[model samples]
Target chain A: MMSLRSFRDPVLVALSLVALWQVLHHIAGDSAITAPAPTLTHLWEMIGQARFLPHLRETGLAFLQALAIACGGGILIGVVLGGHRLTGEVAEPILVGLYSVPKITLYPVILLLFGLGMPAKVAFGALHGIIPVVLFTMNAVRNVNRTYLRTGRTMRLAPMQTAWFILIPATLPEIFTGLRIGFSLTLLGTMLGELFASQRGLGFLLMTAIELNDVKTILAIAVLISAFAVLCNAALLAVDTRLHRGAAPETSGK
Target chain B: MKKATWIRTVFLVGALGALEVACRSGAIPATMVTAPSAMVTTLVKTMQSDEIGGHIEQTLSAVAIAMALSITGGFAIGFILNWFPVLRRAFAPFLAAYYAIPHFAFYPLLIVIFGLGSTPLIVLATLFAMVAMIVATMTGLDRVPRVLLKTARIHRLSLLDEIWRVRLPAAAPHLLSGLKLAVAYSFIGVIAGEFILSTSGIGHEIAFAYDNFDNPRMYALILFVLAIVTAFNMTVYAYERRLMRRRGI
Candidate 1:
């Protein structure tokens, strides 16, 4: 019923957008670029060709690899910093310092050092993905239950054992949240790297389409990118829900 | 705790400095890895040349104007959306879905429609940032407590008074969070815009440096951007702190 009502609400805006697109299509018809439908169709046709998959694979593989490295590195660093109060406090400001800087500025360095290949892209993506991962990991570690810690100590558990058995479980949920953010950023970083210089990748395709003024292909690829992002987000969210359910206390009612 | 903090700080800083030194002076080629000292020289040159300042100013001007415009626009739309649930039900999903849409892809379309430079850049930033404010304001207003509203209605309080005394203040925190996120989005939009096709701007500087393989110059720009962003973040942090203090938040 909610979806049905939602559908009823936007008919006018939808109609108006299409109408404006068509008007712009005809009135500014001086160049082939004026209309959106043809470009949209170009986007569609690009998908039907066999050439699309390679770039997608190249981009996705590089992104996934970078994300894994970043996740591990970020969480490890974050855990060490965030485990203690003063260190966490001091490190928080420093993280914020680095986070604000646009990572795109490092593209030249990455390309020069890593040689314009998937390695460069992966490194760039890892840098992009790591900051948030570190931030959230710190938060997760700081938020471990102190009372639980006292109980574990009372039971004569070794420090490492307590951390492994106690803190890790509690940190899982927030760590997952960080991973989600990091994963998205990894994609953005990889795409940006590819755009700067790549023999093969989605970013390369996007640039190619734009430079060629092939609006349709750009739109088609864009659709694929958006679909991929949504799919990734949904996948992360599913994992998050599962983790949340598993982490919940076995008993609820008094 | 203080000892831990000091240890971590010393370790991280020392590690970074060591790594930088290794990358710069070790077996790695100078062409491959620009030294920190070299990067500093590059930054100094860019500053002396006043080339990057113009670009920074251009980017900041767009971000400031776009953010201000969106704040007003978002507040208005959010209020209106709250006033009419019919509109809310209609537009909310579309807005939510598009929020995640990279829209960076359609950036070229923006260029097609609006041409090169500030118009497309500023407009895109505004559009991207505005949605959050609208959603935040709408949700905040919708969740206004029932009894106070009932009492106001029973007392026949004017709509203006009810909104000012009740809704606005109550919704302040959410609105501020929305505004903060909007600022981040605006920053992203400006950079992405410049990265894609702008003739000038900080993003253009990075792209050009990369194209030319000017590693030190690129590193300089990145550090400069980091400093600027850190400054922006402090401003927002201060603003948020002041608001919280004022509101007893």
Candidate 2:
């Protein structure tokens, strides 16, 4: 059974958030924002609409493709750089610099190259999500216990076997953390991509709502996206914590 | 210079040279991307024309205000939260989930509430940037050595003095990193908001140029933004390294 103490904080946070929303709604008036209750009702209505499915499908497809590229490309780059010390050192600063740059500025360039479509959206999403995964995986690989490598060598394992059997398992926990962070960033990037110069998707809907001064639709969409993001992040965070905890004792024992 | 730095410099230069070659040779169409040299010349010419000065000033000032607000306000809020375990516990999940929420989604809502001007942008940017500082402050405070607190207590220092003398110095590194992130996020929030919808700013100009098929001007503006941000970050990073070195960390 879940403990009361553990449940209490989230409830309190949720109530306070609702309270803040209500206050803001009152202050901003009906034209600027709908009350929380009305917004929730509007969101339900939105979910049931025939047109909503296509936009949902578009966003979901783009997000999944972006996630695939981000995870795969990030892990591959991470493995390559991490396995080679000099390369990792050379690339580290460059990666960090790229991470901080407001990549939104590059959207025009991306559009010019990829054109206005799924490719552009997926590319933008992957670009945001890839860096943290690389950074985390690189560190995890670098920190792999020397004894494990020695054991692999002693067993006369091939390089590929060593990587698969030894390296991946050892770094999985930290790498999972990277993936969790990457998941959120990729979603953010994809949504940002759709926000500008897109004809369909939730972001496009949001833009349309903004132009039409449709406060209810805007809030409903924002709430919907934020809910999805938070719920997914919470799940990933739970798995991430468990993995890290599971790894701790093994390292200490070693 | 160090070997890695040397190699990195060469690598960067080579990449730029390759891009220049491609652009000049029609391998990459001018419609797609302007040459690196052409981007530089256009940027220089744009600066000389001074037409974009107002846009630059608008973006930079908004970023500056957002950074200032987030840094100071975040530190204060973080300090209070750290002092209250109950509050911290309640807020922890929200804090953890904060960045995932696609904050730009609220830009239109903010515009509606605050009306069309820099207010909404500043508020949005501040909200976006402040959490980094708050998280950093909490972490920095949490990691301050127990022995330092003991020393402070033994000296009979007041709470304010204890925090100022012992806590702040000990937490300076994390705070500095937080400062770096705040600056970056502020720029991101402001530029992205302006890019999405704004009457005047560098981001708006870039979007305007993009729509008009002014590839040269668009690339030049992009180049300018990237250069300034990179330079600013490098300065902060250098300062952080110097501080770390002095502290023998």
Q: What's chain A's TM-score in each predicted model?
A: 0.77, 0.93
How many clashes (backbone N, Cα, C below 3 Å) per candidate?
4, 0
Q: What would the per-residue lDDT of candidate 2 be over residues B1-249, giving only the tens digit for each residue?
A: 788888898999999999999999999999999999999999999999977999999999999999999999999988888989888877866776787787876777788788889999999999999998998999999989899999999999999999999999999998987898898899989999999889899999999999999999999999999999999999999998898899887
Which lDDT value does model 1 have at B154? 89
- Candidate 1: give the clashing pairs: A39-A216, A42-A216, A43-A216, A43-A220
Off by over 4 Å in 1: A1-45, A147-173, A234-254, B1-41, B50-54, B74-100, B128-181, B242-249
Error of 2 at A196 (Å): 0.4
Global local distance difference test of model 2: 0.91
Q: Provide DockQ values for all models, in the order shown.
A: 0.39, 0.71
lDDT string, candidate 2, A9-96, tens digits: 8778989899999999889889887899999999999999999999999999999999999999999999889989999989999999
lDDT for B209 in candidate 2 is 96
Model 1: CAPRI class:
acceptable
Please give, for residues B53-95, the per-residue lDDT of candidate 1 as tens digits. 7898998899898889888999999999889888776675455
